[model samples]
Target: MAEAIVDLVAQGLLDEGTRLPTERALAQQIGVSRGTVVAAYADLADRGLVVRRQGSGTSVAAGRRTPVGRHLRNDGFTRQVSGPAVAIDLSLAAPVYDDVVARLQANTADVMAAGAAPHGYTPLGLPALRHAIAGRLSAQGVPTTAAQVLVTPGAQGALQLITAAYLRAGDRVIVDTPTYPGALELFSRAGAQVDGIPRDHAGPRPGHFERALADGEAALAMFVPTCHNPTGTTMSERRRHELLAAIRDHEVLMVEDLTMADLSFSGEAPPHMVALAPDRIIAIGSFSKVLWGGLRVGWIRADPATILRLGRLRTAQDMGSGLLDQAAVLAALPQLDEIIVGRRRLAQEREAVLRAALTEQLPEWEIGRCDGGYGLWIKLPQANAAQVVNAALQHGVAIAGGGVGSLDDQHLDHVRVCFTLAPEILVEAASRLRAAWQQVCADDGTTTILAAV
Candidate 1:
């Protein structure tokens, strides 16, 4: 038997056009039987990979040949190509990874080693972990029970479960465009129509949501009240009340994702719209940013009946989040305050460096009015963000470019610079960005300016 089979094209180590040696040649060289090589080929065939033809040798599959920097079709829409290898990266919105994550992962493995594979499916989740989560939420005065909390893989999974439980094909789900990119994909996969409302700087545009809901067919609306993504805007308390009243009047179920709330740079959080309207809201919270991305632990706060409905639908997706991820998150919660403090420090320093650089170097650029969140949404004097990003990447810096920042590509001239890099890295990043911006300005002498004055 062969010892192992490797993905031949994994790192371009096996170049796309190159072919592996014949099974007889490989077996003879490695001292393994041809039967083993045959088993390895069978594994490759099972993966929908490789092409085999009668009287012809096998060739590389079509799947692995996707261009290294081509547009990726993720959820539904196709995203533009983002060049890899950069001196600076301001494209990703994720928090920086550090030692705390490693420590938690070490602890997670210890627990799993204790008792990993139990009897048939711990579907609802590990009981001790669920109880810990419930007890934690109750401390927030959100009125949760262990039975009311169903641990999904992430807030993403919880959202899917809720959509699966409530929606049929062709039902309309409301979204604020420039909303969470993943949620847009989730709604698409569920076969639900997304009624995208325009978003203003402070969450959804006033009365825009009202018009979308006017058609009584809208069944659900998802909102990110605290630390809304992309724009770094939060819905005000007054607007929160208005949003609740509007959704209640329309009888629309609200799904609020508070994924980034813990990183609020302002330290001020509005009362969760969910807390204000419990009967109408399904709240999803995550440890992805607060703890670590690999943790992938998130909880859903819903009615007990809603939880039971989710439990039945949960098996269709995953067995539940891994037990050790839950155990690690629970262990990390008491130290959660420490983690948040470290994160706040990192965010504050990075944002300050970015702000200082923008003010001193590129003073003419328009930075949006943001009180909280991890990204800086700024507009160039005349540069097309998409074009600028292309030029900037070639010059050794990569910035996130999209009109998807605001509803309907309204900010097509703008770029979103994520400020979640480590402090030292962020300083060097800003220096490179200053150079990139200069190059972008040089490349755009013919373009007319979009003047705010």
Candidate 2:
């Protein structure tokens, strides 16, 4: 069996850099003894088919193209797929649709039927949809009409449109450190220098942000005022008002991202900053969470002049958001309260399960007190989060978090474990994780790094 595992890798049949199964999982899959799998790994290491690092466990050599395994197939194609086979996908912050999803599906044809005209290149958006968006924002507090709304494909597109309009190369932008990773990447891609502001449990650190603004480099700031990503911190109204006043004084553009705000995990939704500082805030919202993600729909509520600029940019990017999706989301808006109630109940239940499970299984680690959102940010005791993640992957329990940068001292200690997985898979994944931790912290040197991190 050991010789067979080595022979498969030697033949260039498996793709380079694909994850391999754990000794236990491989043994079960192959109907062989766990000892046989360990011997197979030892044999493979001797031939340099894989490198067995002390802390990192095992991985294929960079040049190795294949491995000897029943799963390996050599039909060369550029079809790259990456996802976890674990029972629960606690990785992505996904919301279940249930009634909302079915209702939208049934009424999708109605929307298409209504907007069944030649919408080839209307720059701003459909008048009815824009009006609906404007109405929604006004209801939320940032009073606006259709003239102030510019519909985009998604929150991402809305971001790009705003960035293109106001940002340029060498421009300085202020962002909260460890905020949405995707938005951070977008800022970098748009050619701007990003300065991170320190944030606490309350909200963005006002002292740090004011200092950044005082530096006179930053002309814009992006913030998540409600249920921030990863941390799940909600910025208090007082804190938001102070920040907005500072932005107003500094003549800075404030971009508000409220994609997850509507989830209302705790029934206390923070006031939208756009309501208080409508003049300086560019508010972006999306239906990806409330509705289905497949619908590429999101909206921006800004000053009419800003909307005009975004309208031209929207024309160049892509005509407008899907008419069908816009209609479906409009229909779901009235049912928004019902959806939030169900989602919050489910999220709370999941959180409770996760908290109890962590207490019973991983007593040493401290779970973040995030009452909202899809996952928990766990602080492990003497464990490398990334090292643990790579190890967990082989054990068939995929997690989220990796190295932030080459120079970053690994953030493996702060991993975000999603509670969205089912109970059985969650238990199995946690148990397998306990097993992986033993291997990761077994050695003195790796254990030391784990301690320091």
All candidates' lDDT scores? 0.68, 0.68
lDDT, candidate 2, 1-453, per-residue tens:
643444454465544555568888998997989998888788666645677766666777666432121112211010114442554345566665465577774254555544434644556666667787888777777789988888788787788888878876557888776566556555554546567776777788888888999997675799988877766667888899888878877888889998878766777776799888777788997877666666678888888888888887777777677776776777677787787787777777877777776666667777877857777777777547767766666666666652231012334466777766556666666777666666666733453222221
The C-alpha stretches of model 1 lying farther than 4 A from their native spots are: 1-85, 106-117, 167-169, 405-408, 447-453
Each candidate structure's TM-score, on Cα atoms with residue i matched to residue i, is 0.75, 0.74
All models, RMSD in angstroms: 10.1, 12.8
Error of 2 at 162 (Å): 2.0
Q: Show model 2 residue runs off by greater than 4 Å.
A: 1-87, 96-99, 106-109, 112-117, 120-123, 402-412, 443-453
Single out the weakest 10-residue window by summed lDDT for candidate 1: 67-76
Collision count for each candidate, in order: 0, 8
Tell me how candidate 1 scores on lDDT.
0.68
